[model samples]
Target: MGQTSTSLCCIFICFMLAQTVFQVESANILFFFGVSSYSHRLPAWPLVTGLAEKGHNVTFLSPFKAKNPHPKVVDYAPRKFSEWAESWDEMNMFDMRKKGDMYKQWLILPYFGIAMCEKLYSDEEFINWVKSSTYDLVFIDALFNECGYGMAHIFGAKVIQFDTTTVFPWYSSAFGSPDETNWIPDMAYVFGANEVTFQNRLINALIPVGWDLFRSWIYFPQLEEITRTGLSTTDLPTFQDIEKNVSMIFLNTYYSEEFARALPPNMVSIGGIAYVEKRTPLPKDLAAFLEKGNGFIYVSFGTVADLQKMDASTQQAIIGALQSFPELQFVWKLRNDSLLKEFPNGNVYISNWMPQQDILSHPKIKAFITHSGLIGIQESIYNAVPLISFPIFAEQDYNAERVHRNEYGIRLEITTVNQAELEDAISKVVNDSKYDPDFKFTQYSTNDA
Candidate 1:
């Protein structure tokens, strides 16, 4: 009896030791996700929740809250944040697309970053809250959201960037990630920068330098000024110094969807983190409509393009082409539903929202007609659906150009596509058989770490 009791006590002591070690390994993490869009936040949800599941205390600061949240995660947003964010969302993409400026990508985004800085820094209570909190790691959503670095400096924590798109030249330079300018193109460059022409090569080489100068001379300096004001901490470091101290970068892309780039040990690719949920059953009405036609095609410009406010000429062109193709069913994600009455087509179906994964993965889906956003392209690749892309603005042009180069899809000229051009492009993409999947990124990325 004495021997048995001693053995049981030893087992209990071992269990207690294991539990203590587990608690020690857990951390207090801060996610500084401000007024980023739904698409940007969606992919990060899995990462946030997954960390929480592992017993880490995650504090998420966002302008919006998750519809459902993990038990261990604490959420915060200023009362006025939602209202301010809604106004930015209401900005017209149609007007932005009408203007043709090559420098728009490089210059316009930094201007927006300055605005986001003002919005976040202006809230004195929020600043005080951050100052009081403790953290082991700080996460910043990259792109124009670089202002997040300031929060990291305040907490004296390790910084990691959750990049919405693949890495950019500025990020590559700042973090010392691999940049093979000879084959791998600049993210902003349209149609894949292969360095085929002397002019193109020169442009690619100078693009990074121009943006770096702009950041050094204009953007980062403004950010640093905002971060320093009213802070009682006697020793204040420049934003550039803080930027260099980032410990890791978790991009929303992986080897299957994007080309395998030479990333450093600190750079980890965690693609499709948001796509953890399986595709649920489609609505009966949508299923019935899809079944009624011999074949159907899917169309969307991602979530941001308020199709209701889209340019009238562009709408007319798309409508005209759909009307011409009565033989095939069309599933269009045009939030402006009145168009069904205005230009009625027997074979067309329009909805304000779509379950993209289900529709793309469906056997009935023949091809996709899209504006070629990065997420849209990734969806198409995930389902192996060919693309008919009209890349209008920002990274859309770059994505469309990539589809064109890779031969997985065809591109329609953004500024010049009329009814005939739209029809021709759609038909060509439907019939083309030249897409090479070996070059495409299709695997489900599993790097959650």
Candidate 2:
């Protein structure tokens, strides 16, 4: 009996020691997203919230504050670069699309990024905080928001970069992934999946290569200088060095929607990171509005689009399109409430904002009119809502092409779209069952391949 008791005590102590050795401690994570829009914030939100819930301390640093706050997450919002963003000129962008001046747009992005980094680095409080803080991991935005690389160098932490969209051409080069422009067109090319031909293939290849060279020669140098100046040290490594050693990259794309392409092991697709199975209740007024008509078609140009700044003709085209579908109620996500008076149709309900996912989840929602933003497209697919996609800028046209290719919706070129064209697109999506997104086929989750 004595021997058995002693053996049992020894076994218990061994078990305790094993537990001590195997236990995983919570980490300090810094999510640095400088000079980004609200759309950039949503895709990585689940990651932030997930880490926080798992007992890690998460610092979410961005100009945009959290729409929904989590207990374990700290939202750090510094000065917003509203002036820089506003200067981009919404009208100029529309004009550029009309004139096919897409190449010129890429030239301005680096300047914006450098300016944003300078703004962040200028804040004395932000600098002091960075100096004092110790992070185990740094998650940085892969856009012009590369300034966060300096912080990762300081903390000596593993870096994780996230792209809010599918891997761009620059991403392919930087991460050493196969771009294969012969078969796969650049995101800026604005062509269908199968439209990559011999003539435009050279153009596709050169665009990314040129952009990469511009970044390597001009953008990175300026970024390196500013980062060093901000940190007050020349001892830091170059952005390229830090970027090459990054631990992982999370892309906001799914395989089922994409053409077959080779990917590096470190690049992960966390497409439905923001997806939630449960739906939230809509506001009283919004709920009442949805209940009134046979069904509503949801329209939103996305977070960054300044529809108010759009020319009067385009605004009238949109308004007229909604009026054409008088039988079907229209729920438009327009920011200017006063502009509601411009819509003569009583069936049109305009609000600055509404719970988009909840509205999409509603049984009465017949179709979605979108800017073909990836998040909106994913959510629309998840809810089996057909789309009327009008792509504006960035990779939206690419996304719109996919929507059209998959028979998920109709893609309208916003530059050439008139009231009649808009009306026809809306009419087809609302009336035709062929446009309905195949939820089972397209729906992706964290577990998706």
**Residue 332 of model 1, lDDT score:** 87
**Residue pair clashes in candidate 2:** none
Summarize candidate 1's per-residue lDDT along 123-178 as a digit string, tens digits: 78877786888888989888767787777777778998888778777866788987
What's the lDDT for all of these models?
0.75, 0.81
**Steric clash pairs (candidate 1):** 256-441, 256-442, 257-441
After superposing all C-alphas onto the true structure, candidate 2 shows an RMSD in angstroms of: 3.4
Candidate 2 local lDDT, 25-85, one digit each (tens): 9999999887677778888988898899988999998776788888789998865443445
Question: What's the number of clashes in each of the models?
Answer: 3, 0
